[model samples]
Target: MSLELANYEAQAREAVKMFWGNREAALAKQVASGNQDAGTRGAVTAGKNMDGFLALAQSLVSANGLAMADIHVQRRVLTLPGFFRPTKLWDMLVIYRGQLVAALEFKSQVGPSFGNNFNNRSEEAIGTAHDLWTAYREGAFGEDSARPFLGWVMLVEDCPASRSAVRDTEPHFPVFPEFKGASYSTRYDLLCKKLVQEGLYTSAAFLSSPRTAAGDGAYTHLSELTSLKTFVTDFSAHIAAVAAR
Candidate 1:
């Protein structure tokens, strides 16, 4: 059977708009209240910036097949057992007939401090995937549960700082050729691809949009491998397959 992509491109554009709009609104609200946070913490603490993307994911689950699946978005019910830690909270979870269908993480990074934030995000992504997979292998879900689809989606601010090549100092060993002078955007693309390649995630997506994206919801994908299209297509297919069974 053909997979249903659920018209994700248009929905993703709207999601981008919502992402930027939310951040701006959050920042403005804090400033107006005379309680602005340090740096961008005000906007970050507001949360719900990625609700639009979460809605798109929910639509995909229902439109493609599992209309009745329990799509968990509430914070209280999103925890899953982890191997390295007690539990991990996912951004979204899909459960059907007592079986875990999918788990997804949606993340975004804004400018002025991409370097530190990028490193932190990378470590978190890698650790989260490793912990989950290890738990899965140990029957954290169920003894006979099918492998659930794990996905990661990232949104970054597009600007000269994020796109410009970065220099790295290697004292003893040389860095990989591909990463020798990779920009923050390129590094994200590489991270997404490697996550999938190493089976850390079933699929990963990397997106970039300028602050102006709040107006038109314009976004860019670095590569087909890590594009939102590929991410949703693969996810839709997985959901469809599980529904068929």
Candidate 2:
């Protein structure tokens, strides 16, 4: 089976709709009017909007020989064993005959909060990888023989706030050369590429979409190294190999 991108434009638009819907619902129900939390808290409410991408991911698993029953998307069974933590909920997971096949995390970033969330996002991504790999090293996934494929996808909103250059202030020591004047978008692209280079993830994708026209399914890749095409190509190869075995 071949790896082909699904109708991403429709899915992306759905994600945007979900994001705004969740945030608006939260604002109406969760926080006090005119409070600082009211505006910002809603931003975190609709994170699951990106779950549509998981459907595309599921396609990869299905194409690779795993059946629908083998893949888990619901949070209940999506929990995977962790080293530092008892367990972590993953966005998507595939298991075949008690052997771990793949686990992926889908994440997104939207504007007005990029600055406040970038560091947290970075730490979360790295820490999750560390926990999973360490757990695998300790034989966390039962008697599984081969390593499980780990994937990360970052969908950032394409807006002025995210694309503008950001200043770096290194008070104590010098920051990395790549991030000296990188914008949030560029920083995320670097993060995706570096995660693969550092062997933290099997494949990673960096995507940008605009909220208003997301339904048009328009998204941009920051670089070839971190592009979704590359991620899918690598992941397809891995999954195809695993299925063959």
Candidate 3:
């Protein structure tokens, strides 16, 4: 792994761990103080997973020497002038370089199969894309050059050992109400298809081995996965090269 990759990974790991520490402490206190929901235990675990995803996403970008536009970006559009106005909000908008380069929604899961989880995420991405497209059309996003947009659904690998811990107290993990029981593979497949349809992502591929090349529709594993660091390094370089062009 390159020094840049290693540094980003370390930073990401620490940030995620800190996020979890604070979140878990809060939840635990709630439980200890008798204000906890049994169902919330699952949700807590899911939150940890989300922390990991967020950290990784940040790391992925930072490894390329890119910083998010701001930690928190909420841009709104109000249609109509006064009483009949409707407002639209965009969550966690980010910028890379001087251009509006990227946007992402992070997700996490602790289950064997995605089942409906996939659908909900897919729908969310679709809606986000729709909103972005609408905003672009309405001139809310400005008319410089077209920027890249993306949706990400990060999942925790479901190994046999972690399943019981994940399911003991929580009946269902946090799933989008609409997309219950959807498989991860299915979700990824559909998302990739939609991204292609909308011209958002050029390609997707599964990372079978550390040596796997980035290709069309590839789904890379996160754990024990070789070459991920290398892949990110290359990805960062590629993005920089593209931005230069």
Candidate 4:
């Protein structure tokens, strides 16, 4: 099966839009009725719903090129020998060309800037990478395998916040008690560096293309907008890349 980048982008866009529309409708009802709690809960519920939609989207994208029966999306924790620590993750797992190819972590945000939620997501990605690395080192991978796994951070760029967040400036996440004094971006960068240096990741690329310098008085586009159609197309190419790995 081949990945369809355009379709992926379209589906992602539609799903997000639908999720937001539903949220807004509910919020409007609550506001008219003066239900503050409902509005508040609606915000949280919207995020959860988006997450669920993304989870399913990952599966759909994976299923097209790969056998749905063989491949698993959102694989849970499977304890490996000698690596006793358990960390459960919901990753889009691909079994391409008879080999485990990639594990994707889809992230969608309205704004460019990442808030507390982004911190959690970064932690999840880093932790999942660690677990996979440990498993591979302990001979957990199947025969005819690609030992190193790939990681992806997919974004739906719509809000100004997200635009500001992914700018060329140094990225930083807010600090929590667990991270002590380090910025979230600092921590995330360090983790990514270590993983890449250790040969855990193949190579890193952002789906959103950075704006380029066009001619005089013009701006170049950097990050590419991801829609359902785009996602399917990108998925096709990504699958091919993983197979070559």
Highest-lDDT candidate: 1
| TM-scores of the candidates in the order shown | 0.97, 0.86, 0.54, 0.52
Error of 4 at 130 (Å): 2.6
User: Top model by TM-score, which number?
Assistant: 1
lDDT of each: 0.93, 0.78, 0.44, 0.46
Clashes of 4: 51
Per-candidate clash tally = 0, 1, 20, 51
Q: Name model 3 segments beyond 4 Å from true.
A: 6-27, 41-49, 59-91, 96-99, 111-114, 157-198, 201-245
Model 2 shows how many backbone clashes? Answer: 1
Cα displacement (Å) at residue 101, model 2: 0.6
- Model 1 has an lDDT value of 0.93
What would the per-residue lDDT of candidate 3 be over residues 119-188, giving only the tens digit for each residue? 5756765655666656555655456746554444343333442222221223677655323443344345
| 1-245: candidate 4 lDDT, tens digit per residue | 43334344444445455545555565666677776463246543434434434554455545444444244543353222224465445445555554556555655433334566566765665666667777766666664466534654443333344444232333596544434544334334444444445665543223322112111111112222222243344455565455444
Q: What order do you get sorting by lDDT, best first?
A: 1, 2, 4, 3
TM-score of 3: 0.54
- Of 1 and 4, the candidate ahead on lDDT is 1
Return the clash pairs for model 1, or none.
none
